[model samples]
Target: MATSNLDLADIQATVLRYRPEPYYGTHVLLRIDDARGGREFLRRLVPHVASAADWWLRDDAWIAVTLSYAGLVALGTPEQSLRSFPASFREGMAARAEHLVDVGLNGPQNWEPPFGSSQVHVALSIFSGDQLKWRQAVETAWAQFRDLRGVTLLMSQDFGAQPGDRNSLGYKDTIGQPAIEGSGVEPLPGQGRPIKAGEFVLGYPGETGVVLTMPQPDLLGRNGTYVGLRKYQSRVGAFNRFLRENANTAEERELLAAKLMGRWRSGAPLTLAPERDDPAIGADPRRNNDFDYANDAHGYQVPFGAHMRRMNPRDTRLAQLTDVNLHRIIRRSTTYGAPYDPDALSERDDEIPRGLYFIALSAKLMDTFEFLQREWINKGDFMTLGRERDPTVGLQENDAVFTIPKHPVRRRIHGIETFNVLRGGEYLFMPSLSALRWLANLGG
Candidate 1:
């Protein structure tokens, strides 16, 4: 089940669904099942995929398949699962690969499972309303897969979001997206930032164990990129209130949200038309990633402190931007738990604590995840002055007291408070489709 190139139409034809990638969104993961005789089991399953598109469907749509030390006990026959596979198995399918664990490496036979090892976690992106049906299909499929040992499912949908939505926040999600200028994925324009060959696929000679390198080169073509999955919570109510109280004018409030977010809610990027909404420009594929911040001298038009500006500054020199943003993740976050009910908007006490199940693919986590959290999002004044805290999901250094400047140019401090908290997250290196198959049948 390997193909050189999988067009969107063909992918849609097979999955019977399609979702054009977005800058910010949700990814839903369903824990399906696990098998113990890992490599052997996967070896037998790979050929059964039937087509290359099926492999891509699994690779792009499925999240990481994390195995644990406790997996041996869960295999039901610890002794059998503990037995070592031939060296050829290591050579042919597992040399220099990270996390290619032996049965008893972490602990002797008597030990329990490691922190997250007892089960194999399988995840899928929540594309649309059809996800419920898709989840059911995935559950049935895994249960029926012969190699999987015992299957149990847990729905993980609660997660957080990046700052700035259309309504009140001064932002839009994924401000500067790279248009494939010459067929390859060049993260964005202004700086010939072409997504390198090794960036997305694996099994290439130099790419083994490299987190940013692509995993499945033989199966996926040159442009195919790997996605990462994460979940985060957003304090929409608190964020909305902050803008209402802080902003001097409705226009300023709207501008701030758009600036911080990188786009107007109408999906327009502040880089192109910073002042007002431009529906046509935002929607135009040819023009969206065409602008740069060099034109804005004072950081007023598109604030230097703006999340989009700081994250993707569009410069080879002087920008001091990290190489991470080049591995641009297409965030597919969606609100989970309970829908934002119009009636609940006015409630004195929220009946349910809600958030997002964040998901996206990146060549490396540091480039995408850590940088966004530690540098761009967490740093109170990212690229400019008076822009401390994202007001929605951004972390405040201290809960005791806080303030944000009125304008990116003014630096006038305004009182603020802590908003959201990051409850939990894990850095999972989602393996290529072949890697998953190799993992499933380890000993068998």
Candidate 2:
């Protein structure tokens, strides 16, 4: 099916669209004290929730609303309907800690307030490219909930976030969100054939040529999708220190950075411009994400264990080759905290609280998002690298080390500490506009 047949107007915009032209973002978690007020909150916010219509157009701002399992219960969803969701989502991010490798410093016990707690029921997010438009949209959402006594704001993170698609780590990101089969936007260079709509939106046929079970009472699940919200605190100082310890000259440090990531800081893929930083190619959307790893099988240009290469591994032969598209998730990641401060380290090793607000969208969170964190990010057996994790964002073992493939000999860089710490995370279900109404009218 093409873009025309898809129910664009019913699906939430965040599911298919990137909230694009990205510049700023906000994440607000809410607690529902009463079922009636929770339903009313959804009712009032329904009109404002963005739809996936004309996804390519440049919207100044967009609002997104999603509910946790607790949020659904607070709205009084039928128990049978509640059981319809996957155990992964029903259990939520904190409960599935061991499976997600959220241990040690990244444990849920250390998570920011209300993130892993059941107190957080609803999630509201606002993204804008314009300040004035962003404020209006945020105020509009606040107006919806402020008057309700049963609804209370739990926490809000990310304001005036980093712009131009650059992450706090200083490398360019948001480069590889897969294209959906019927998302209407023209597929960019590296976004292989658009993924099946069912792979993303609920109630559609996936790549397996089957529709995975949707939540009961079709109104609740159709046109909806699961979301995994993660707040990462980037250890910029540690990251900077790692580079300095590994290399001597500025040029060598940059090359190591490129080797760690699969791209230059400018978003240029190392596969395309291996020897030096190519600002022109990095800035060009057409060419930046187009190249594949097939040509550099040995990972001489792009290390096999590089962050992007591990997350994507485009055209690279895997020991167990599975359809890469099956594991793809749409990432609308945004950066937060003070702009990338190089000197952000304190004597206590307490780095600045700045990192990416990782928003992942997929119909099958277990198969796509969870699987990536498990097999692709935390382990390297699939890539034929024993016990090696993703060098950039993966959970690193205490004695973790990174290996860079070179011509004569491989360069092994040790002290590969975790750069991105999981401050908190949660699983949410973003309902379609119609589903929001269905929720609003429930038990009314």
Candidate 3:
């Protein structure tokens, strides 16, 4: 996960391999008041932090640590080191509300406690499929901070797969993942040659053949990366009602679902199985992300505004407009709350709370995640669809329209609404393992 040295031992495993599939996890935010205590906390937590060495097959559960800009300042980071961070991250997510479309209902002022606020300084995330392992990881983190009065626990949330292992929206999750050059995993059919390590990890050459400028000191930024975590509470009942009112038949409802998502609930992409879903293909990783938009030039199968296509234009002409590769981001999102009843897909049940914790890891926050949020997700002109936004995550109006390009003529479905609402969001920097030790030894 590092440079040519491949210093996996000095880098957090989450930078490359996030959680394994079908995983359960807990995320906790903290605020620090005492610099010495904060450094000591890092001192004790380093041993529990997992590195990228042979990360793919690791059986043990692990915890990843990230710090907001204020966290670094609270830890007594030197002025030079603090000045090296980009303004976007330094300002924090809440300050950029307008740029991220966090305005309206998703504004920072309406966010949950500890989020969208400078009070948040630390984020500890645990990932594991086994209940015991997950519990142990949480307990490990608890042991470190529970007694440290200087460190206050702002909030904690648990996330995993919904019933039948689908996302909150009743669709398969973790469908698309980036293929990084040094990550040991072989690229899937659709995932081209692994992206340059620098595109993801710091201190390496990206696809552009240039090293991404990092934090001032070599130690702090060598393997560090940026992470943007947004808490979304899905309006499941409203979404189900939206589908029921729009489509006439069950089959038509399913088709409409596939069209909206660019993939069927089974995870089969519309490009390969546009007419009907092939669960076999959906379940198969080799074929799931293999197809491109070249054959579907007019977007007959996958619409231009489809979330997947908009996120990763691939080799299509639209890719040129945005240089999709430059803005490619690694997602490791997790669903929170109890699993919903899939049998009653249309039944309204807004009383209970459940949604996704959208996590994105990238080398540069502004050039990647923020870029997509402002240009691609919120605005429609990037791909020539005026006023169209991402149907799933886009901040929509009462009369938003989702155009589905089809045979004979294009079908325009009006009255689209924002399915995912932002309850909380934070931008943090996940430093390298060596940086962790550096922070621990601070003020020495």
Residues 192-234, candidate 3: write the lDDT tens digits.
7678888888888898999988997989999988999899988
Model 1 Cα lDDT, one tens digit per residue, 1-444: 122322322111112111323212233333333444334433443443222233223213322233222332243323433233122211211121122121222112322222133232333332322344445434433544344444444443422232323222223333343322222222444434544323333222212333333322323212223333333344555555555666678777666556555667666777678669887876565666677666665566665555565556564133344454354554444444443332232323232455554444443433445456555555644343333655445555444222322353355434443344333333333344444443454455
Which is the better candidate, 1 or 3, if ranked by lDDT?
A: 3
Q: Name the candidate that leads on TM-score.
A: 2
TM-score of 2: 0.97
The regions of model 3 sitting more than 4 angstroms off are: 1-5, 342-348
Candidate 2, 44-116: lDDT as tens digits: 9989888878565455678999999989999899999999988888988999888888888888999988889
Q: Each candidate's lDDT (Cα)? A: 0.40, 0.84, 0.84
lDDT score for candidate 3 against the true structure: 0.84
Worst 10 residues of 1 by lDDT: 9-18
- What's the lDDT of the predicted structure labeled candidate 1? 0.40
Error of 1 at 250 (Å): 4.4
- Return the lDDT, model 2, position 152: 94
RMSD of 1: 9.3
Clashing pairs in 2: none
